[model samples]
Target: MAQRELVCPEEMAHLVERFNYAPAVKVGQMVYAAGQVGRDSEMNVIDSSLEDHITAAWENVGKVLAAAGCGYEDIVEMTTFHVDLQEQLPTFLAVKDKFIPRQDVPPAWTAIGITELTFPGQLVEIKVIACVPDAA
Candidate 1:
C-alpha cells in the first residue's frame, strides 16, 4: 500500500499555517497540487495585464511543482479555470508555452471557462498532477 504524505514546501508554508491546506499532497509516485492563482507571495491578488496575469499563475504552479520535487516535464495532467477563456486563450497559450515542456506527447490539459473565482480581480487559476518515478 502506498502511504499518503503531506507535501508542503517551506516556501509555501503559509498554505498550511494560514490557509489550513497543503499546497500539494503527495502519495507514492503521484502528487496532486492545489489550484494556483496569479497572486503574490503573500497571496494578494494582482491586477495586471493579461500576459502578466497568466504568467503569475504559472509561476505559482511552478512553486507547487518544485515542492513535490517535480518539473513541468513530470506533469501528467493539468486543469485550468479561467474567468474569460475566449478572451484570454491567446495570451494564456502564449504564456503556457513558456512554462509547459515541449514533449513529443504533452501532458493532458483541460481548460474551463467561468465567470469569477474566489477573489476579485483574479483572472486565472491552474492546478496540476505530476507522476514521477520513485517520487515518494
Candidate 2:
C-alpha cells in the first residue's frame, strides 16, 4: 500500500503548542483536522468578541484545508465548540453563510457549549473532516 500524505498550514505550528496534537492528518482519502481556535499566526487571541473569534476559527480551518489541497466543498463534517452557544449561534451562522453559499451542499455540523478551551480568552474551536481527491 502507498503511504498517505499529511498536510497543514505554516500558521498551524505557531497556533498550536508543539506538545499538542498536530493540525491535520491524512489517511487514505480522508483528512482529519484538529480543533482550531481563534488564534492568529502567533497563537495570540485575535478578537475578544465571540463573533470575531468564531470567524477566525473558521478561517483557520479553511487555511488548513487549503494546505491539504481541499476546500469547504470537500468537508464532510464539522464539530464546533463554543463557550456560549446561544449567544454565538447567530454570529456563527452569519459567518458560515460567507463560506458556504446557498447553492453549495452544507456539511454535517454539530455545535456544543463548553466551559473553556486550551487558551485563555479563546471563544470558539472548530474541527473538520474532509475528503481528498483520488490519485489519478
lDDT of each: 0.87, 0.82
In candidate 2, what are the lDDT values of residues 1-136, reduced to their tens digit?
7666657687666434675566888887788998988878777897767777877888888998888888878889889898888888899899888876564577889999999998889988989999977657
Instruction: Estimate, for each residue in 12-71, the C-alpha lDDT of model 1 and write its tens digit.
Output: 787688778978888987999888898888777877687887898898888888878887
Clashes of 2: 0
What C-alpha root-mean-square deviation, in Å, does candidate 2 show against the real structure?
2.4
Please state every model's RMSD to the true fold in angstroms. Answer: 1.9, 2.4
Clashes of each: 0, 0
Ten contiguous residues minimizing lDDT sum, candidate 2: 12-21
